[model samples]
Target: MPVNLPEIESMELYPVAGVKLGWAQGHIKKANRKDVLVIELCEGASVAGVFTLNRFCAAPVTLCRQHLAGNKGIRALVVNTGCANAGTGEQGMLDAKKTCNAVAELLAIPQDAVLPFSTGVILENLPMDRLLAALPNAVNNLAEDNWKDAAYSIMTTDVAPKAVSEQLNIAGKQVVVTGISKGAGMIHPNMATMLGYLATDAGIEQSLLTEITKEIADLSFNCISVDGDTSTNDSFIIIASGQSEVQFNSREQAGFAELYQSLLASAQKLAQAIVRDGEGATKFMSVNVHGAKTMAEAKAVGFAIGKSPLVKTAFFASDPNLGRILAAIGYAARECDSLNDLDTNLIDLYLGDVLVADKGGLAKSYKEADGQNIMNRAEIDMTVKLNRGDVDVTIWTCDFSYEYVRINADYRS
Candidate 1:
């Protein structure tokens, strides 16, 4: 069950002019489910991506870097669920290459222009025969309004399809931004976790698109955690089709800021949806850490609180265990590998607006009932203040529950 998240009943996924999507059931692992996706990009589209930092990254991830580095422009994206081509050694790389090659051949584009992605069970080889056989069908089924199906096709353990769409006027032209993301566990993204694809029809330079992709990812995908275990196939990609005819030369252009804001908002909604649908999650939490010396420190502090099993369980039980939060903060502070720089005496903590801890201990005005009232909500706001500087960051997470344990323990079955 998802935590306080609503199903996208109408699924108003807007179509960018240069993008088309399709899916097929290759029976790679399961039967009767659409487990493969193909996203076809037009000839002039600009694409950029940020991938997982895991050293044991998947074969598709390696190929994606190589394809993007070739600077030949991305033409198509081939993705499969049910068999993550990871931990299969050189064979995995070959399988990823073969999938890319098939897509490129079918689309009549250069092999280097195709990027492949996979998710689901690791340490297994991709069923090349089934995947390659389905390529032509997926290609034939491509459509501009298949975003809803594409969203569902990429899901692994996600309870529902995650997608968002936004439209804003850029230079008097209607610019559309639409995106989808999927992840229910193993989510602490070093660069970007799970898989997210955001596309815009507004015209922008390739270099600017790459820069903004990383910038928006830091504020969105990189700020969320589900199980604190980073996956080997995490990737987030952004494509600018330049189909809207609203050209912008620099960030100072009139419509660029609005476009950027709309894109970021859409990306953030997709990211938060993943946390709300976190595997076995019952509560959605916003962990904010403020007054840090740098953005990195603030993020570290927020992630520490968000990833703490003790704190997560407390949230699940609606227990105002203030000590658990403080302990997590201290541990996170030390984990930063910086000098012993955190001073508890200068810290303050709040559950919603009720101050629970101050000067390193329980606040003078602390009340358990107030904390309990806030904790009882399906959505929670946790704030930590380290009266040391001005920087702040927020991370999204979910309360762990019995279902989370059950889901993972029997995941492979």
Candidate 2:
């Protein structure tokens, strides 16, 4: 069960004009499950993405970088859940390329025009035989409105598929922004904690998209954590298909700002959904760090609290242990260079609407029962005002429980 996460019902997901999606039950990890997906883009679609910063990234991640670096237009994306093609050395790369070649062959496109992604169970070779056998059916099944099924296909531990869709007018033309993401465990972002894909009907110049992709990632994918472990196969991709009349090639264009913000909002929703559905999560926690000298400092303080096991477990048990949180902030200040001069005496901590700590220590008017009342809720907001400068950032995370350990301990079985 996911913590306070709503189960998405049969909902509308608008399809981007030039993007089509298909899925197949490849049984990459388990039988009778939709474990494989393909997203085929029309010719001239512009695509850009950011991947894990981990040095030992998966084979498909390495291949994706090589393909994207060529600047040859990407035509399609293939994804499989289960048996991450990582730590298998040369064989892994071969298997990844073979998966691309399979998709390319089916689509009558160059192998270099395909990007591949995989997730689940690190350090194992991909089951290529089943993957190859599934590609033809996946390609044959491609359709413009299959976004919902596509979301389900790429899931691993996710309790429900994560998807967001929006329709907005840009320069008198209608633009559609829709995206999906999957992650439940092994979550932390050097780049992003899981796999995400976003597409829009409004086109932008490749160079500009390449620049803003990182920006979109920073504000969305980079601001979340689940279990504090960064995955080797993490990736976030954004695509723009020039099928609508709202196409633009530069940031200076008339409607780019509106389109960009819509994309950002969609991306943020998808990212937050992952934390809400975090593996064995019992509480959805928002750590807001304000009045920081820099964004880097704010993020450091937020993650320090978000990833703290003591803080997370205490939240799960509905305990407002203010000491655990204060300790985390003290250590974050010590670790962040920008916060070297951080003054604890100027800090204030709030749990939801109640002021628990004021000016570095417990607020005189605060009571234990008041703190407990806030903690007992399934969602919590912990605001820390560093009073150092004016920057702010929010980190989304979840509380750990007994089910968290149980889920991971038997993950392989």
Error of 2 at 334 (Å): 5.3
lDDT of each: 0.90, 0.90
Reference-based TM-score of each model: 0.98, 0.98
Q: Tell me how far candidate 1 lies from the true structure as C-alpha RMSD in angstroms.
A: 1.1
> What lDDT tens digits, residue by residue, belong to model 2 across residues 1-413?
77665555335788899999999999889999999999999999999999999888999999999999999899999999988898889999999999999999999999999999999998889989999999988998999899989999999888989988989897778889989999988888786569999999888889888898999999988999988888899999999998888777778888788888998898889999999989999899999999999999999999999989999999999987878999999889665887777899999999998898899999998998999999999989999999989999999999998888988999999
lDDT of 1 at 116: 94
CA displacement after TM-score superposition, residue 337 of candidate 2 (Å): 1.8
Q: Can you list the residue pairs that collide in candidate 2?
A: none
lDDT of 2: 0.90
Worst 10 residues of 1 by lDDT: 332-341
lDDT of 1 at 411: 84
Give me the displacement of residue 244 in model 2, in angstroms: 0.8
Name the regions of candidate 1 deviating beyond 4 angstroms. 9-11
